[model samples]
Target: MDLRGKYGLLIDDIAEMRTTVRIQLADSGLEKCDAARNIKEAIERLSQRRYDLIVCDYNLGQGADGQQLLELVRRRQLLPLSSAFLMITGETGYEQVSTAAEYAPDDYLIKPFTSELLRSRLERILEKKEALRPLYQVLTDKVDRAKALAICDILLAAKGRYVLDILRHKGQLLLESKRNDEALALYQGVLDQRATPWAEVGKARALAATGNEEEARQHLQRALDAYPNYLAAYDSLALLLEKTDKTAAQEVVEKALKVAPSTQRQRRLGGLALENKDYPRAESAFRRATEKDRTGFFKSHDDYAGLAKSCAEQGKIDDAFAAVKDMGNHFGRSSDLLARQAAVESLVHVKAGNPLAAKAALARALALNDDQALDPTTALEIATACFATGDAETAKGIIQSVAEDHNENETVIQLAQGVFLAAGHGEEGAVFLEATRKRMIKLNNDAVAMAKAGDLDHAIAMLTEAADRLTNNCQVSVNAALAILMDVQRNGAAPEKFSRAQTYILQARRANPEHRQLADLAKFYRKLAPPGTPIIEET
Candidate 1:
């Protein structure tokens, strides 16, 4: 527990606990300690400096809990691999969340513990981290997976105190690398030693990946029966159930939400409820999710849209309008958000029998789309509003574009079918969707053929041309940019093409700001041409 010259962060909501922890860390030889009362503050402090240790409480008021904060930090690459994180909790339910988390702290200390116990736990965690330093380095950095696995194997050969942990890490890497059979075997072996909850869940994951759904369900149920509050088991069980039974999946999520009502789980529950046409439940879930999300670092426009739609469908025009207002207040006036918000507002007005007001709202939505075409999801909202306002032609056009761009996405196709059915055009919608799918398939197939035939230039040209024709289709723009970047990478760095790639990327970003691939691509472009701004290395 010698922390001399090693900075640390102590996070806890209770002022007394924070003081106690700070004193304990200072007594343990830490140079100094920074403190945060919540996830937002913790993120700000961590952003400023890399700490040697992070002591975080499992619960931090009504906002994001310690588990969620850790997940976000790890996802954003805020904490370094060498920083030891110790999560403190009084609730036994935390074990399930920690077990299922993709990123875990170095160790956990239960609350109401003696300082001796805390020091002992920290010392043990530090020792284990020291032993696993090499494996962690390879795991965290840009290294070959095979090399990292080999390093794990070497460390495991010593039969050390961290043997089980090493096995777990190796199994996870194996699963991530698509070596499901080996991962399953390794998880089963861990169960033989002792049936830990994490091992059971891992085995179930591997089983599900291998298409052994029945066995996976059984294993997941077993884990839940053993630990009823295991959030991870609930999540896996719900996902597994969704493949066959939506009602069962919804129930599982409902059960999990009662135990740990995270914004993400609540939003998912709302989505399921919406799909089931349970307007009241969907409205409640989405409202709670929207409120929770507003307190976080990022806000989700989809949640606000969902809330407004559910409220309008339930004939709660005032609540629906309020939801739309909330979106405008929180997210400013981004065209994409504005389009969706205005569409939802129109739905409320139409439901309230105010045709004039509904028309005005729909007109605003249409103007937004005219300025910058809407993405598929936002377009769906606008189409719904148009149908409500008795503007079938405009709705049809929007739905046609949606189906054309999203033919491969079953969810979007289903959503379009629902919208068209609501508008009294089910049969025509089906025909339009089918025709659009066929055309898009042909377009995609032709470009892919050129790509496969080694006509990189032609393939890039074709995709870029399609992108111009489909400015709002994020997938097309992203794919076109990625194709060019890949070709350049394959031919060694081509600096001349970087600007072209960036243009496509920026366009795609404008169309779908939340697209996941944008982050990695931005990082790639930055490496190719380092920015003039100061660089902050990702942990």
Candidate 2:
């Protein structure tokens, strides 16, 4: 290898580690290399320049961990196809953390590795990168599947050291091309030779793609049995359990967290707790996650926000305010956090018998998001705050919004209706809900007409474009998008269209909780999608 004209990034929390990796990369022919002590600096560098290689330490001391950084890059498609991501991890709990197969890197090097081992890993990655250069180029350029597959075929035909590598790439291409049977066969062929966890997981995903949940579970179990620390298999099993058994799903998440308690896993567990209305557990999980990493894939202002909401639900005012204070300190001057804090403050003031302060806090929160209405959960909070202060009119308005946007979200609708009943307006809220449901139905029907006319693209485009315009039509937009996606599938097209539709549907569901149809649509799309598409959590 020539020692010139290569760019690289080295990210580590320890000064010694950064210095060591930087010197090693320079020695290995990297003429240009930048080192960052933590994820924030790494992201800053990533935003400013392009690098051919990223050597990241798995345990960054602050901000995002190495795995979260890798996930963000891969999820956002930030890294170039030609780029090689080589994760460096110490032996401590390595097996537990090593289960991150879903966020696959080009290669990994264990810590305390000699220069020789580092060189060997890098050389192997470079060799594979070179071998698949043509396919990589086509993929990076967003060329059609046929061109990429053609290139993969050529490489697969003549492989020696890269034989397993070529098969993996070809399997990826087949999946991308929606040739599930061929991809399944290829993966099975690999599994037959060696019971590799990656190949087994691939087969399980293929089984899921073909709507064989029982078989998928069996394959996933096999992978888990062979490699008990395999995190990807646990993730797949969790997803499979989500629709069928909530308790089992929660246990699956807990098991994954026990193996390697990353921020992502904790956040998922927190979400499950929230769904079960286990406010204390949800609060603990969210708080733990926020305290662990200040900035990462799980570094959501929402985590703190959720914790505060959970505390308020359990009447833990002091704890709620403390969480709010943490948010203010962690994310200085964030509008999202500030708005959430104001909402919490309003609740606190009302509970403390300060009607004036509660009113002012509510106004400030509404002002912060440019007066945009809150979600059903937050609306319920606001309603409680307003009722505590004897502002029945404001409480009615907040509850009405919840009733209207969340007619399908039974949990929320019931909560809001309870607020109205407590405020002596149960009949009024019911009447309001009926009228809103009628309006939602009409809007949904109109969107469905466009889809039925075979204008699914236009229908989706129009619905999304008008999303802002239809301020109260959250359920309608989501249902319409799902309908159009199903129609597009019936007509048969590329998965991208369905992917786009799914994105909109997910957004709508986030805005309006418990849209069952969205879940059903997601399950349908998952079956139609090629194997190994990243599994999205059911909201």
Candidate 3:
């Protein structure tokens, strides 16, 4: 219960409220407390230092709020799992803050609360965090789920007070590791004991992962019917529906938006609506996302870029051009900015019957891609522009490059497909990306085969080259590390090889922390290396 050693942050727009809370926290033995006036200051503090606790007021000024700040920090990982967030809300915001279990704070306090009540809530959350520290360190710091899973089992076997919490973590770890049967069993076990909404949704996710999509959808529907405010259930159901029916997906998002609106959800709605050719809906969604913060932290070039495309699709050339111009005010000036703006502007000009302007814009976009391509998203955006400007070959070339570099990244691949879909080449994009994906798979397989055939050096060379070039591809990085480890396993491990292997393993972890095979690779490195090789420190 002692908060003397804990670093705390107090955020409130009103100066008097911040002073009151800081004094209260001091009275409660929390001396090391920093204060922020609003979301921007909070983010700056969080980035500069990690606080053990955060106390925030719900209604921050400038249309920003504590909940939105929490979501933003959590998404960007500015706030680690170890930190405890306590929201202070008045009666007006209690219902919305209370049922927002999707991204709820660790605990919340109603206004006019004493220091004792705040201290009690802090003690409880800190106690649970301490009990699960080992698991969190492994999962968050090392990205090793096997060790985390083992720790969860140990904690569960101890019959601890936080057994439910442990079980939830274990179930998620199971699903993430692709142990669908085990995950399903864990969820079912939890459901048998009590009908928790998370367990219900987890069970549905498990079922879907194991190829029981229909059954999963039914379970999700049932979960929604029972727990109407459970946002995760809505998101899970929406994702499933997206595979076979975009219309259903959009409808699900709409309902979720009705329940609780978020910047991420709005962007998702915009994407789905755009794909469905509902230009007005897309425009509305993207506009909301772009204008919601005005801080430019939550909104990306993608939002403005999306708004531009949505407007252009509706023959609102002026509105589309305005969006394209707005990008200059928001995102940083770089190759990415130039390319994205030009790309969207090309589409707008094309829609306005200005072929010369459209061609000029497309040329500038292509020039950026040729000289200094920054990110996959921008590359794909330029590809879309290429298609819009009647330059199919350049668009395909850009798509192919981005796809090869991000062969294992579904989000990037989908973004690439969106480019083609926007250009009336959905089927062709699907086919082209599929062929590229399969080809990459075959190449990786062939390298692995070569390693299995005792050609470790050649395999290492091929994989290392690919991994270095395609740095974003975690699968390639994993294989490269595996090839090196296989060599070390056969011949004695050299210090340099061990070091390089560790580097690749770490690289893969950074690229895709949620990669299903991450645990397997970590386990492999542990067994294949010297004692305390420090690949991933055990917590």
What lDDT would each prediction earn against the true structure? 0.80, 0.72, 0.87
Query: What tens-digit string does per-residue lDDT give for candidate 3 at 417-481?
Result: 87887788889989999999998999899999999999888999999998887777789999999
Compute the lDDT for candidate 1.
0.80
lDDT winner: 3
Best by TM-score: 3
lDDT, candidate 2, 242-267, per-residue tens: 65676777888888887777777777
Q: In angstroms, what RMSD does candidate 1 have relative to the true structure?
A: 5.5
> How close to the true structure is residue 434 of candidate 2, measured as C-alpha lDDT?
73
Provide the TM-score for each candidate, comma-separated.
Answer: 0.79, 0.68, 0.89
Q: Compared to the true structure, candidate 2 yields what TM-score?
A: 0.68
Candidates arranged by lDDT, highest first = 3, 1, 2
Q: How close is candidate 1 to the true structure, as a TM-score?
A: 0.79
**True lDDT of residue 519, candidate 3:** 79
